[model samples]
Target: MDKETAKNIRESLKADCSNCFGLCCTALNIVASSDFAINKNAGTPCPNLNDEFRCKIHQNLREKGFKGCTVFDCLGAGQKVSQNIFNGQNWRENPEIAEKMFSVFPVMEQLYEMIAFISEALTYEVSFSLHDNLNQQLEKLQNLTDMDADSLLSIDLVMCRFPIKELLLETSQYIRSELSSKVFAIKKGKECSGADWIGKNFSGKDLRTTDLRGAYLIATDLRNTDLRGVDFIGADLRDANLSGANLSTSLFLTQMQINSAKGNEKTILPSHLQRPYHWI
Candidate 1:
């Protein structure tokens, strides 16, 4: 899928979190962060993950030093493959079938990567012909991704490894420099508001003076996406990875958005800017 299309799918996904089964946190091997010192095996739920499936340590993950967990984004793996495909059966509640679910998780994760990449590819006008090819691949991945755990585990691991590796490489390429030829120009100055562009590749695109107020830009690859002079007022920046992103001159950056966005020690904030209160 092209970049634009990928973005659209991702945007719709954020709104559907409640439907997810919390699969990644409960069904995969995760080395804990400060808040959670222990690593968890596939099919075992994280202790910090609460009954509601929300992270009990969400707010204090880092101060509590669970930095490793804080950076994770299943890229909506929980909702798309787990909730929608498997009908929300997570490994935690099905230990007898835990191995089956664990085996299927990576398979679905690879597919989720494809979905995200294809969605990104679809956004560009020049990639129109790619639509059919992407659709085919997406359908195939979706089929495997949505399979019942029994069927999912029965697949040959040796045979499936090659395809997953190939897909992962192809998907990675799109996130790099592939968009230079299809650079975006917001002509007609069409207004965009409250849009969800999380985990997308809007890198290096000039979004100066754009109105992105209240948009959900979580984990978006904005490395070089221009934010020289835009309104970021009220945007939900929750864990939106902004490393190397230039927001030094952005406008109306609310305390909430700044707090939600993730930054490192090297982040260059404009003078008079205050770090978010909870980013520790």
Candidate 2:
């Protein structure tokens, strides 16, 4: 796929909450924690969700102790499930299908997330060799979204994600290798994949080409860091300071990750990502 086509696909994968029926607020379970004010069960609507299927605390989610709600993104699965799958019928109005709709939501979420990653992978010129495979996988995922609710529920997400994960890793390596030079390497340590760097001071460091997949970077100081070409898939960036950090070319950095972290107006992000509303 070409860049423009890939861009369009990525845009479609973003959450359009206005067109949704509050699936994220009703379909998923919530655990009481630092992020959530109350425990909620799956298939139950949040107390804060109003009659119009909107969150009453939409603007004050964090202050109201629903921090987890702010960090969650369904990757457009909510609307897809609400409108496309159910023909605009909402769970509150159509009580008979409520349980089935809730069950299909998480499955759709996984598919959309995979599609988002593959769509991004296809945009990198360095990963052109994998473009054919990526496009095929993307097509497969798109087709899966069109499947009936029962078919969607039957999907084994583990099996579906295995190949996509391998492809993303390959794409990340190709892009990073093409962009990063020896000067961008970390001098002290060679490995960073899945490393536990919580609360570590890495501010202003050149972290280019670092394979930081699944790294625990919670509360880590990364302010003003040069992070071009770093792979951040599954990295715990909650409370990690990103003020003035340059991630314009970072690999696999998602909106959810950015939403969970802290940043300032000086922080640079990829062209496709939106700066969080809370960022100063």
List TM-score per model, in order.
0.54, 0.95
Clashes of 2: 0
Per-residue lDDT of candidate 1, residues 24-110 (tens digit): 667778665543578788777777878877788778777776655544455556576566556667555755655665566676665
In candidate 1, clashing pairs total 22
Clashes of each: 22, 0
Using lDDT as the measure, which candidate wins? 2
- The whole-model lDDT of each prediction reads 0.57, 0.88
Global lDDT of model 1? 0.57
Worst window of 10 by summed lDDT in candidate 2:
181-190
Writing each residue's lDDT as its tens digit, candidate 2 over 231-275 gives 999999998999999999788889999999999999999987889
